[model samples]
Target: MLAGFEKSTGKPPEELSLPWKGMPDLKTGEETVEIFRSWRPHSMLFNLPNGNSMALSHEDECPLHPRSIVVVDDVYCIFLGMLLENTCDLRSHYGLSRQVTEAMVVVEAYKVLRDRTPYPPDQVVRDLQGKFAFVLFDARANTLFIARDRDGCIPLQWRMARDGSLVCSDDPNVIAEACGNCCTFFPPGCIYMSGDHPLNKIRAITWEDDEGNISSVLFQVDLFTRLRSIPRTDSSANWAGVTTVDGE
Candidate 1:
């Protein structure tokens, strides 16, 4: 389970490692609370095969508790966040509510997966304006998606599991407890997808609108050996891969 602060260490809680040997098994309700009794009470636990479990807890500063973790259909997620702007435009595009809150953004995200013939596009999330980190799991597809905001204001961390699954959370200690010095912070401004179907690479393209609004869009495209024909920028070597493209 993702936790806030470690009750004993006084530091942030560790991202709980699932299926690690010797760790106590966590049940859905009472047993889960017993482990985190001294910490926050808002804990959600899901038991997996071979005694593995996933848990998530909201921190003290978060206001999206109780309703933070949601499970609809075969998709489950633990989200902690607040979108900086109203989602009227995004929701309307998806035919959702103009009054939808950021807490419900996961629902829209799920809708994209269900309605789209293929996987959702990266622009689906790149256009989102918010400060948040979430872990989403799709049971039917046996896939996992983890993402954090661009600024990294919200905390998230992860460590690899024995089966190559990512054990991630908002708490570092939870990972440390399971991985024993293997835990590290999850990178900001990125989304991680894992499953039978996965994205190969993430790319960025920049262009200008008729109104002269320079827009940068991040999305996924087919893998290529090398990108040799893109336009270059005036920036020095420090700028590296960032180049500009003219929009028609």
Candidate 2:
């Protein structure tokens, strides 16, 4: 399973780190055996493009809540790390008049996707108060979306495969094993989407401005359309000062 990554990254098997809150397990003389087993039962693996794959896991004792994944129809969503419910806008939106659990939020997100809510996914994400990250994949549409909480309390990382597929997970070591030095942290307060071009192409749901600061104003308009208007620049500098909406 990791052979492709090992051949591509050239870091060999010993240097690799297990994805999430786990470590690589190697026997004597650097003989690779297995990856560190996560204490959290919610950990899972997913198939990515170009034969690549991704995984999500968390520390059972360290994290406030266990991570989880929910699949609704063609959409698969994974929620990792903790959430601050009091800061979440559950009462105002999604018609959730009562307290919510992590599973409830997952269901609501699935509903939003099924209903094709008029609002951008980022808006829904903005209303979610948490120190976490999520990856949503629409199998039928071949679209992959990722989002991180504003404070970035939880970590998410990604690396491009030799086949140009994007492999993302919450573990930097997982990325390191796959990408070597090519791995990087996913930006906070931003929604990343790879539409149609799910293999290697990804664009931030953001607009460019002279001040090098991203303002929340763009959230009021059609986000995808806005992304279309802006020129496709590969530089991350354009993402500087990008702002995300805060819930009331």
Winning candidate number (TM-score): 1
**Per-residue alpha-carbon lDDT of model 2 for 124-199, expressed as tens digits?**
4545666777766556555555667655666666433343234555654544444444444555666654421111
* Pairs in clash, predicted candidate 2: 214-241, 214-242, 214-243
Off by over 4 Å in 1: 1-42, 48-53, 63-67, 98-100, 162-165, 196-248
Q: What are the Cα lDDT values of the candidates? A: 0.48, 0.44
lDDT of 2 at 93: 61
Candidate 2: list runs displaced more than 4 Å: 1-43, 46-54, 58-61, 87-107, 196-248
lDDT of 1: 0.48
